[model samples]
Target: MARRFVTLDVFTTRRHAGNPLAVVLQAEGLDTEAMQAIAREFNLSETVFVLPPERPEHRAALRIFTPGTELPFAGHPTVGTAVWLALHDEAEGGGTEMLVLEEKVGAVACAVEVTGSHAGHAAFTLPRLPEAVGTAPAAGLLAPALGLDAGEIGFGAHRPGIFSAGVPFLCIPLASRAAVAHARPDMGRWQDALGASAAFVYSHETAEAGHHYHARMFAPTLGIAEDPATGSAVAAFAGAIIAHEPPGEGDHRFVIEQGYEMGRPSQIVLEMSVRGGALVSARIGGSAVVVSEGVLL
Candidate 1:
């Protein structure tokens, strides 16, 4: 039998914007090699394979795969898959209900509330605590690799660090929006500096959009020069910011805008809290749109 897949755009209010993901439903019999091959064929940032839930408490088993390898968890895939499943009636309680999914990382929970029959319409929330792996990249090597001058890097907020809710990314804060917009990595220097980090470089700009931040990410090692919008990176960024920001401030929440240079405008809401030297729960949420609904076969 031929396999089937559905493609959807995530983190945007319209189709063709946001990150694209392919969902392979009911992929119980497919092996790992086959899944990877299928993922490679799809060639999206990530693809999701839905399997039978091992335990009764879980909704469905979700496996996330990048073009290169399988990831323990990912933000867009989780959000897009939940919405897709609900639209197809595979998830519980129909379109208005919250969907709980099982993945390698842990049980993830999200809700898809439909606004209309329009292809690009749905609100998604990843209601789970983000866990940090506590691994960070060195600052010395990172500065030169991104073509960032010593003066362009801020002292407190610009410190190079690593953070992850699921996948670890090296978070770098630049001095200004101009610095972020003009940043182009020195491939040789980046490869040399972050070889051991296995992390991507992410930068941001302050925005007036309710939350005061804009963001961008680069992962040349993964064969992606830039990601249109990265939810995982946003979550990781939130973790690092909460830890680095000064005390005596109330909780901070921001909307991170990205993908302008790529022409696919994207938005991500990052929320976090830090207390007693430990960063508390970090959550990243975004809007998704179903650009197309067709079978891979």
Candidate 2:
């Protein structure tokens, strides 16, 4: 059987930028091993296999996979898949719609905005709230892991820490964009400091004027040395921002610029509502462009 697939550049309005995701539609028969092999073959940051929703109310069930392993839930894959499905439905007379998807973590609600037939924006509430998993290694240990000096390891009250929304990452705050841009993960040190978790590095300085911060992500353990855009990282980042840069009791929005160092500059919009000095809710939103489609025999 030949399965249909579509590729999209997620978290950016334009093509050839942002994170590239391959979504396999009509993926009814593929098993876990087959999906993993297909994900490895795509070699993008992530690949999504769309299957029939276990529940009739949901739009679809998503199986997200990195080159190395399957994920309970992921941001870009959800956003990209939602947008692609909306557009696909639009061609068949469906207009802008809200979709509920079944993921390993839970049901995810996504709002998709379709302009015409091709370009669209998608946003989704985090399936799980981010929580502090644990403390990270000291600056002395983390600096070498990311090829940075100890002095550049932190900014403000933000130090290295572990956080998870659905997936976990070792979040490191750099003193400047220079440190973030120059980062190169040392395999041995990375293994010691983060083990299986990926690294999400960020700094207050940004390349664009309207952006609040500059960021980068590295997941060599997952076969992704660097990612152009990472929605799941930003989802967990809401916790970090709330912890270190606590906003007054209200809603706050931030635009993060990432992937400039890799020449695939991307933007991610994060919205969080805070009340009683704690984060109440969070959402990740971005645009995606469909680039290609084909059938896999």
Candidate 3:
């Protein structure tokens, strides 16, 4: 069967920058195994298989996959797919559009801005808020896994922990921006220190002014060497952020800088709504551009 597919650079307006995603549009008849195989062939951070929505009213049902496995939900794919749909499948010319994407986690509500240029912005409130899934290994063990010294492992109130909105990641806070840039996965110790869990390393010092954070993500177990940008990690990091940063009751917006070192420099906008000193809701927003489109045989 022939299916249509488009590749997009997510979290950035540039064509070659940001975390890359491949979205298969005519994926109605592909099975789970076939989808996974296709994802491996594309070899991007994540690939989206768009299926018919169970509720015909919704936009589409998405099955996100890394080369190694399927994800209940993923950030880049959702953002990229939404923009693609708004510009192509659900075009309304030039206005904000509201749609729903059904993922294994649940329904995700998205708002996309239709624009004059190819770059369009999309934001989706997380279907599931982050929850503490488990404890993190000590700084000593974590440091060796990422080729960092124990001293560079943590700063301020931030230590290492595991959090998941839908996909789980080990949130590791480093001492400085320098420390974040110095990270290199020690493949020998990585698997033992963290089994099948991706690592999200971040620092307070950022590459861009006014940016709240700078981050890097590593997920070899999921067949990703390093991700240019990671929305799910940022979403999960919100749980850690609220615990450590502890913002007062209100809506807070933060710009996260990522992928600078990889040359794909990407930015992600994280919005958190708080009430009574507790987080109530959160959303991830970014822009994506279609780089190319072709038919998959």
Best by lDDT: 3
Model 1 Cα shift for residue 112 (angstroms): 2.6
Worst ten in a row by lDDT for model 3: 88-97
lDDT of 1 by residue, 1-297 (tens): 566778888788788888888889778788999888889888888889998888886668988887778888787887777767766663345554666788887777665666445332333333444445655445566678878775665544557677767677877777777777777788889777776344433344454446456667887676557887787777666666665663333455677887766788778776565566555555566777667655655
Residue 296 in candidate 1, Cα distance off native in Å: 3.2
**Whole-model lDDT, model 3:** 0.92
Error of 2 at 42 (Å): 0.4
Q: Compared to the true structure, candidate 3 yields what TM-score?
A: 0.97
lDDT-sorted candidate list, best first: 3, 2, 1
Model 2 — TM-score against the truth? 0.98
lDDT of each: 0.69, 0.91, 0.92
Candidate 1: segments with Cα more than 4 A from true spot: 90-96, 118-140, 196-204, 246-252, 273-279
Cα lDDT tens digits, model 3, 185-213, are: 99999988998889999999999899999
Which structure is stronger by lDDT: 2 or 3?
3
Candidate 3: which stretches are off by over 4 Å? Answer: 90-96
Candidate 2 per-residue lDDT over residues 125-155, each given as its tens digit = 9989999897788889889988989999989
After the best TM-score superposition of candidate 2, give how far the Cα of residue 55 lies from its true spot, in angstroms.
1.4
lDDT of 2 at 192: 86
